[model samples]
Target: MGESAKTEETAALSVRALDDETWPAFARLVEANNGVWGGCWCVGFHVKLGKGRTAAENRAEKEQRVHEGRTHAALVFSDDECLGWCQFGSPEELPEVKSRRLYEKGLVTLPDWRITCFFTGKGLRGRGVANAALGGALAKIARLGGGTVEGYPEETDDRKVSGSFLHTGPMVAFENHGFTRTRPISPHRWVVTRTVAPA
Candidate 1:
């Protein structure tokens, strides 16, 4: 992609805190982007409900939690059109994620925020859309005084697998942004972090 295309795409994609008015389209984007997590609705880390839960139920539960807790996640939009999402917040804010063994090690003591899931639209894939979204998130968090940003990016040798599962983003992308692996939870899953020291 051309630098202009990247710039144009990045400009079109605005990252902002989640709100009531934007949740519907955000949900629709996730549902429509089948390869990006198969209609997850970004509820994988929010709901206590199992994978067996219906999409509608999962969606409602996630909406309820986000509304009730005031837990904010980063949202990517092109003008009024929603394109992608990245869930980030204090560990306490995402109880389901915080309570899981996958996140237990080295998590209890750190006061940090988590970047749990990401979803980008089919048309917007491989366009540096996620990097821009991440830049937006980092800027927002830094402006708010700074905090640690962490994510579990899957490791893969094949670039084809990288495109198919872009939600976790590529480890190289995170590394390019200065994130380093803190620990490896599994062969595919690794915990990476970057601390934004207070200004």
Candidate 2:
């Protein structure tokens, strides 16, 4: 590709806050990906899953949260196509996480923001979309009065992990954005933290 064309491709990817206005695109992306992680709708972090709730119910709840302004995410887009998203919100807004048992063992305090989930569209995984999404989430958090932000990401340096298992994102992604390793919550997962200044 020519220099300008390469630049254009890079410029084409944008990050937008997930809100009512962007819900349709998010929905489309999720639906296209089989509702994401077995029809999770990315709501697994916000509430306990598998309470006999169907995927349709989960979808409704997610849509309700979006409409009520109760959910937050950074949606990555290429043109009008929603490529993926990074889910972040306050602790109360997202109470559940992987390895909670171990995470609570060292919980001295709650963070202002928690990055709980991530999803990259099929065929778009290794293209820096998740990094963009993480950057976008931090920027949005800063604008909303930033504070200590935490993430639960898996360390992938030692072994190969499927993208399907990395809902909270990879550890290097958080480290790249300046998050420090706080503690190990699971075998290959950790609790990472970063403090962002208010914009």
Candidate 3:
């Protein structure tokens, strides 16, 4: 955990878009944790669109969706090993966010992408994987044509919140990557956004 080791680890890490070819890596990271939040398969964000199914059903549907390239994510890797992941998509892909009233304020149609979820493996949790994944997701979104990207992140004070409740990440993570808070979604959560500069 020395500065130099941290630097080396950062250098060894890379981020890639989640697609059919990389689905296995993303799957492994989630599977290792028993599908994240007791077999969510990272599909809770879509429940507003009426995705009510058993964990087993959700897992199967998610896998089939990924096979069809229906998911968009940023997968962080250390050499060939997957360390973490961040999910992103057009606003249509990630809907029914928390604090709907606050989130809807000043809403517009231009922000085409939404950064919805993140997951870091057990040992990888505190090693800056989420930040890297955030950066990776933004970079990938910019590469596809920079647009307004939105996120919902918790703003924790001295009171500590468990990682289990941070799947959407924290305010600091988005801020570290240059995202600006758009509005307060809740006392602890805020809507944030960043305009990815064109590549």
Candidate 4:
């Protein structure tokens, strides 16, 4: 999406696309969190990590992808600081995913957009940053020619889950955004889908 496109905003925050202009803010938030999940830089779904691949390499590669416009996310900002982000892209752009074996076993067709991961600032947990980021992602997808969108979120009604393990977000969050539970991909995780009309 272009910079001129309309941004998704809330009373306390605004959402912007993760691009050249927003890269630094994104980096700052990630850096503050020790590169986010052991230096993942939120690039886990974009590329295969491990086997001596350093966090530094992931950071550099993520930056490179951002520069090349190969990455997509809805970055939430509270004033000038980035609070967090929700990563979204085509299946090809984000090939790696959670519960891959089960996910593929039930996969019928690829979605036009896939909502993979989310990250919120350390102190900003329990706030609506992730929800805002999700709204922002849907808005961005709408502007980018909307279609079928999918997300794998865990059900949290029956038990308590650590926030760190909720990178895909909660079932209530996606449901709040009008996504329907398409099918269960795991014991707790479900594949949710929604259709966003183009803006």
In the range 1-199, model 1's lDDT, one tens digit per residue, is 7899867866666777777877777767766765235545676666565667777776676788767755566778778777776677766765565324766865645547777766678777665667766766677667767788787787786645755454666787678878999887766768889987655
Candidate 1 clash total? 0
Checking candidate 2 for backbone clashes, the offending pairs are: none
* 10 residues in a row with least lDDT, candidate 3: 46-55
Q: Write the per-residue lDDT of candidate 4 for residues 1-199, one digit (tens) a residue.
A: 3333324334678899999999999999999999998889989999888878888999999999999999999999989999999999999999998888989999999999999999998988755788899999999999999999999998987798988778998899899999999989888999999999999
lDDT of 2 by residue, 63-88 (tens): 99999999999999998989999999
* Candidate 3 CA-lDDT value: 0.81
Poorly placed runs, candidate 2 (over 4 Å): 1-8
TM-score, every prediction: 0.81, 0.95, 0.91, 0.93
CA RMSD of each candidate after superposition: 3.0, 1.6, 2.0, 5.6
Error of 1 at 155 (Å): 2.3
TM-score of 1: 0.81
Residue 156, candidate 1: Cα error in Å is: 2.7
Ranking by TM-score: 2, 4, 3, 1
Runs with alpha carbons beyond 4 Å of true place in candidate 3:
49-52, 105-110
TM-score of 3: 0.91
In candidate 1, where is summed lDDT lowest over 10 consecutive residues? 94-103
- The clash count of every prediction, one per candidate, is 0, 0, 0, 0
Per-model C-alpha lDDT, please?
0.69, 0.91, 0.81, 0.91
Model 4 RMSD in Å is 5.6
